[model samples]
Target: MDLTGKVAIVTGSGRGLGLAYARELAAAGAKVVVNDVDAATAEAAAKEITDAGGTAVAEVAAVGRTEAAEALVARAVDEFGRLDVLVTNAGVLRDKVLWKMSDDDFDTVIDVHLRGTFTCARAAVRRMREQGEGGRLILIGSPAGQRGNFGQTNYSAAKAGIVGFARTWAMELERANITVNAVIPVAATAMTETIPALKPYVDALRAGEPMPPFARTALAFGTPEDAAGLVAFLASDAASGVTGQAIGIGGDRLSLWSHPQQVVAAYADGGWRPGAIAEAWPTTVGAQLQTVGENLPEPPAA
Candidate 1:
């Protein structure tokens, strides 16, 4: 996983999983561009890496907009001479059910997670193509996006769109030798604190308690650093042939998620009428109805 002499960018790297990723990449010998919406935190993050004998610089940008995305790529070029990896980790969450989700809530999440990914990848790919060197575009995805989650309509859509980007770009950039993959990370960050089931575990960790094995193994929840390892591995040459995958990682678990595929299919001889379809539904597709949401195991008795 030696990234020596490579230049990389990690957006929203002021803290949380993004911070862990930037630090790991820098530690692996990559010159990192740490980007965040908060100027103070961004500078602080960059300094922390530099003070640790790693090369890093801060770039403050909101992400999502073409101008901000382009500026991040430009910063890497200006400071490190070339861009080798881009981790689109910047995002916001707006949780609400369909009935109660306002337009603003929907738009905010979409702008940050979905559109932000598109713009940043566009800018990064262009630069990577110009350099004519193979590169890595690691996009962050969520379990909420993989399987529908309650009260997260906006967030789910945006994250799903991110994975969609990875699949599409993998095909589009194959000739360019640029690999695209979506990382589905589970960690105890401020983001996960919002999930009711994970809150107690998150709070316990904040109070200096060890994370329970059940949460680590069963829920696949752990520290941000637990998930950071996967991001660094995907960025390295070791994963050069791995592309268009939605890989999950956390505490004690690593998984490969399959793209949408039909488990079973039924056909009608002459395009059956509505009455015939209604009669056959229960015995056909309805009988194999797929489950939604994460299939979590029952926790050990307290």
Candidate 2:
């Protein structure tokens, strides 16, 4: 996991998972650019790294904006000479059911989580191509994205879109030796605190106590530091062959998620008509249609 001489830009690095990623990268010897919308927090994170004898610089920018995304990459190159890793971790949550979710809520979440990752990756890829040294593009994803959440249509869609970006970009940049991957982290962070069921676990983490059984088994809740370790590995040279993967990190568990595939394909001599499809679907594709939220148990007695 030696990242000596490598330069990395981690968006939304002022706190939580992003900050953890930045710190880990810096600790691994990468010159990190800590980008956040909040100027003070970004500066504080950078100072923390520098004070610990690691190289870092703070960049305050809204990552959803193309100019800001470009500027972040530029700052990394200007300050560190070359960029090697780009972790698009900047995001915001706007949770609501489909009917209650407003246009603003949906648009803002998509812009920050989906478009923001695109813009930053676009900027970084340009520089990476020019340098011809290849690089790592690590995007953050969530379980809500993989398996739809009850009241997070916007967040789920945006996170799922990021996985698409990783898969597509992995192929597009493979020739250049740049790897693209997504990490779906389940951790006790500010974001997870929004879930009522996770409050006890988050509180326990804050108080340095053992996690609740439900939290440990169901969410597999861990700290941001646990997720950071995975990101650091992805950024390292050892992970050169691992790309387009949706990796899960929580507590001491790490998982490799399966990509979508045609489980059952039905063919006919002639193109199947609607009637034919109707008859075949039930026996074939329909039978395999998995249940959603199967992993979640019914609510405990109140």
Candidate 3:
């Protein structure tokens, strides 16, 4: 994806997955906007890119803030002339069961993951339309949203919203030649580190519990660079035909078909109902009992 003169903005690029995306894009020749809430960290990340022989500038602003989003867009335009890609990678994890989770916890997670994505994309899309050149928008989602995890109600809800946002926005932006999509990443990031309570699940996998066929596949995990590769392709012109889709990236397992299959099987006899679902529990339990080696991947070391 030779992005020679293109401009790309990656939020939360100060470190971790966002940093990997920025570096990879820069290596592919895009001038980058490294945005983070912490000014010092953002600037340092920019310097890292610059030192590595890539054109980059840092923007310190909270992405959930509309004003900050505008400022971020302005900085990108000022530094690189025009924007070509926007990766809404900034997010936070406020894990708690629905009952125990404080209202503030839920609000904060939503504000950053969903609202921050909205703020940045809203500003970038306008600029993209004005530039008369199509652009790419990639929203980062998570596996927890696809398959609910315990104590992550807030995070899961926000992540799920990104999928819907991409689907709807893809239609609205198609006429403008801009493609919108979501990437569901399950890499061992800071957020995944909090899942230590899943040790039992891990042990069950190792001990060969009755698990779904997909369970065995879940044992594998991907690295940040592994995820960056997909994001790079999505942001490139090569992915022009792909829109309103969600791609999952993990070690050796893309999981592109599993969701569709599950949805189809779920509706085999028309749609779902509470009674039908309840009736299926026994069958579901039986299936799980036959499965093996299904374990959540260990979180990356903090």
Candidate 4:
């Protein structure tokens, strides 16, 4: 997983899982460009890496816009002289139940998560193509995207879209040798601490307490650092042939997620009527109906 000369840009990386990914990539020897909307945190993240003896620089910009994406890629090339990886980890949560959600709420989440991933990948891929070396595009996804979650319509859509981008880009960029993949990660960070099921563990982590095996193994929930190694591995040369996959990592768990594919189908010889489909449903496709939503067992007793 040596990345001695590879240069990377990780957006929304001032804190949380993004920071962990940036630090791990730097530890793997990649010169990192840490981008965040907040100027202070961006600089601080870069400083922290530098203090730890890793090469890094800070770039402050909101990641949704194409201009910001272009600037980020430009800064990476100008600073480190080449761009080899782009981790689109920046996101926001404007969640509400579908009926209660406003347009701005939906738009804000989409602009940051979906549009940000799109524009950044576009800019980075162009540069990688010009450089003529294979590159990695690590798009961040969530379990909500894999299985819908209540009050997270916007977030789930955007994350699901990110994984879609990975699959499509993997095909389009294959000849260019740019491998694209989506990471479905679950970790306790600012983004997840407010989740009711995770708050206790988040609190415990802050108090420097150890996480229970149940939290780490069953819930796949742990500190942000737990998920960082996956990002580092995917960003390195070792994951060169691994593309077009939705890989999950968190806590003590590492998993491979299956894409949404039909498990069963029913066909009519001459396009059956609705009545005929209804009659067949009980014994056919409906019998294998899939489940939805993230369902976690209660955290082990306090």
Model 2: per-residue Cα lDDT over 1-302, one tens digit each: 79999999999999999999999999999999999899999999999999999999999999898999999998998998999999999999888889998999999999999999999999999999999999999999998889878888888888889999999999999999999999999889888988777767788899999765655556667888978999999999999999999999987679998897777777888788999989999898788887654165434566
Ranking by TM-score: 1, 4, 2, 3
For model 4, the run of ten residues with the poorest summed lDDT: 293-302
Residue 79 of candidate 4: its Cα lDDT?
96
Query: How do all models score by TM-score?
Result: 0.98, 0.93, 0.81, 0.98
Model 2 alpha-carbon drift over 4 Å, by segment: 212-218, 268-281, 297-302
> Which regions of candidate 3 deviate over 4 angstroms?
197-218, 257-302
> What tens-digit string does per-residue lDDT give for candidate 3 at 1-302?
78888899999999988999999999999999998899899999999999999999999988798998899899999877999999999998878778899989999999999999999999999999999989999999887766667788888888878888988999999999999989986554566556664344444534666433343355545456657888888889899998999888754566551333332233436866888778876666334543222245544455
C-alpha lDDT score of every prediction, in listed order: 0.94, 0.90, 0.81, 0.94
What clash pairs does model 3 have? 210-291, 211-291, 211-292
- Backbone collision tally, model 3: 3
lDDT leaderboard ranking: 1, 4, 2, 3
**Cα shift from native, residue 138, model 2 (Å):** 0.5
lDDT of 3 at 204: 52
State which candidate, 2 or 3, has the greater lDDT. Answer: 2
The window of 10 residues in a row where model 2 has the poorest summed lDDT is: 291-300
